[model samples]
Target: MKLYYSRGACSLAAHIALYEAGLAFRAEPVDLKAKTLAGGADFRQVNPLGYVPVLELDGGERLTEVGVVLQYIADQKPETSLAPPAGTMPRYRLMQWLAFISSELHKTFSPLFAPHTPEDYKPVIRERLAQRLAYMNQQLAASSFLMGEQFTVADAYLFVVLNWAGVMNLDLTPYAHLQSFQKRVGARPGVQRALQAEGLLGS
Candidate 1:
C-alpha cells in the first residue's frame, strides 16, 4: 500500500495506525497547496479533492477520507487490535468517537486555518473548540483512551486533531487530562515513528 499524506495533517492518524499495525507500506508526501506529488505529478489524479490520506492498495484501489482510511488500516491487522471487531458495540463506540473527532473537532479547526477567515470570527471558533475539548477532557478523565484502556484507532485520530491546537496557538494548559493524554500518546513507539517519518520530530 502507498499512503499519500501531508505532514501533521489528519492523515497522520492513518500513518500512525499503519506503523502500529506493523503493516508494510510506502509513504508518499503530498504538497497539498500545490496539489502535486514529490515527483511533481498532479495529485488531483490521485484524489480529485486534492487532499491527503489517500491510500492506494496493492491491487491499485484507493481509499479516501481519514476515518475510512484509518478503519481500513486497522482492519488489515486485527490481532494488533487497532480497532474493535465489526458489528460490535465497541466498534460502534469507536465509530462514534471517529465521527465526533471528524465533524465536531476537525471541522471546527478548518476556519481558523483559512487565511480568508475573519479575525473576529476566530475567537468564536476557538470558543466552540474549547467546549468540544472540555467534553473530551471529561471523557478522557474516565479512561486511558477514548475507548478505555485500549489505544484504538480513535486515539490515533484524536491525537492528530489535538496536535492542531499548537498550530492554532490554542492554549490547552487548562485541560490537564488532555495535556497528559498528548504526552502519553506522543510517547508511543508507532506514533514517534510516524512523527519522524513526517519530519514533525527529529529522528
Candidate 2:
C-alpha cells in the first residue's frame, strides 16, 4: 500500500495505524494547498475531493477518510489488535470513539483554522472545543486509553487531533489527563515512526 499524506494532518493517524499494524507501505507527500502530488500531477486524479490520507491498495483500489482507513489497516492484522473484532461490542465502542473524535473534536478545530472565521466568534468556538476536551480528560482519568488499556485506532485518531492544539494555540494546560495522554501516545514506537516519516519529528 501507498499512503498519500500531508505533514501533521489527520492523515498522520492512518499513517500511524499502518505502522502499528506492522504493515509495509510507502508514503508520498501531498501539497494540499496546491492539490498536487510531488510529481506535479493533479491530486483530483486520485481523489476528486483533493484530500490526503488516500490509501491505494496493491490492487489499485483506493480508500479515503481517516476513520475508515484506520480501521482498514487494523483489520489487516487482527493479531496486532489495533482494533477490536468487527460486529462485537468492543468494536462498536471503538467506532463510537472514532465518530466522537471526527464529528466533535475534529470538526470543531476546522473553523479555528479558517481565516474567514470572525475574530469575535473564535473564543466561543475555542470554549466549546475545550468542553469536549475536558470530557475526554474525564474519560482518560479512568483508564490508560480511550478504550481502557488497549491502544486502539481511536487513540491514533484522537492523538492526531490533540496534536493540533499546539499548532492552533488552543491551551490544554487545564486538562492534565489529556496532556499526559498526548505524551503516552507520542512515545509509542509506531507513532514515532509516523511522525518521523512525515518530517514532524527529529531522527
Candidate 3:
C-alpha cells in the first residue's frame, strides 16, 4: 500500500493510522500547491481533485478522503483496534465524531487559511473554531480518548486538525483539557513516527 500525503495536512491522520495499525506501506509526498507528486508527475492524474491523502492500495485500488482512509487503515488490522468493529454502536459513534471533525472543525479552518478571506471575517472563523474546540475539550474532559480509553481513527483526525491552531495563531490556552490532550497524543509512538517522517518533528 502507498499513501500520498502532504506534510501536516489532514493526510497526517491517515499516515498516523497506518503506523498505529502496524501496517506496511510506503509514504509518497505530494506538492499540493503545485498539483505534483515528489517525482514531478501531475498529481491531478492521480486525483483530479488535486488533494492529498489519497491512499493507493497494493491491489491498485484507491481511496480518498481522510476519514475513509483512516478507517480503511484501521480495518486492515483489526487486532490493533484503531477503530471499533463495523455495525456496532461504538463504530457509529466513531463515525459521528469523524463527521463532526470534518464538517464542523475541519471546514471551519479552511477560510482562515485562505489568503482571499477578508481580514475582518477571519475573527469570525476563529471564534467558531474556538467554540468547537471548547466543546471538544468538554467532551475530552470525561475520557482519555474520543471513544473513551481506546484510541480510534477519530482521535487521529482530530489531532491533525487541532494542530493547525498554531499555524492560524488561534490560542488554545483557555482549553486546558485540549492542551493536555495535544501533549498526550503527540507523545504517542506512532504519532511521533508519523510526524518525524513528515519532517514535522525532530528525530
TM per prediction: 0.98, 0.98, 0.98
* C-alpha lDDT of all candidate models, in order: 0.95, 0.94, 0.93
Listed per candidate, the RMSD to the true structure in angstroms reads 1.0, 1.2, 1.1
lDDT tens digits, residue span 1-203, model 2 = 99999999999999999999999999989999999999999999999999979999999999999899999999999999899999999999999999999999999999988889999999998999989999999999988899999999999999999999999988999999999999999999999989988888852
RMSD of model 1 against the true structure: 1.0
Taking the tens digit of each residue's C-alpha lDDT, what string does model 3 give over 121-193?
9888988998999999999998888999998889999999999999888999999988888898999999999
Instruction: Tell me the lDDT of model 3 at 29.
Output: 93
Candidate 1 TM-score, true structure as reference: 0.98
Which candidate leads the pack in lDDT? Answer: 1
Model 2 per-residue lDDT at 141: 98
Q: Which ranking of candidates, highest TM-score first?
A: 1, 3, 2
Q: After superposition, how far is residue 123 of candidate 3 from its true place, in Å?
A: 1.0
User: Could you tell me how far off, in angstroms, the CA of residue 90 lies in candidate 1 after the best superposition?
Assistant: 0.4
Candidate 1 lDDT over 1-203, as tens digits, reads 99999999999999999999999999999999999999999999999999979999999999999999999999999999999999999999999999999999999999998989999999999999999999999998978898999999999999999999998899999999999999999999999999999999842
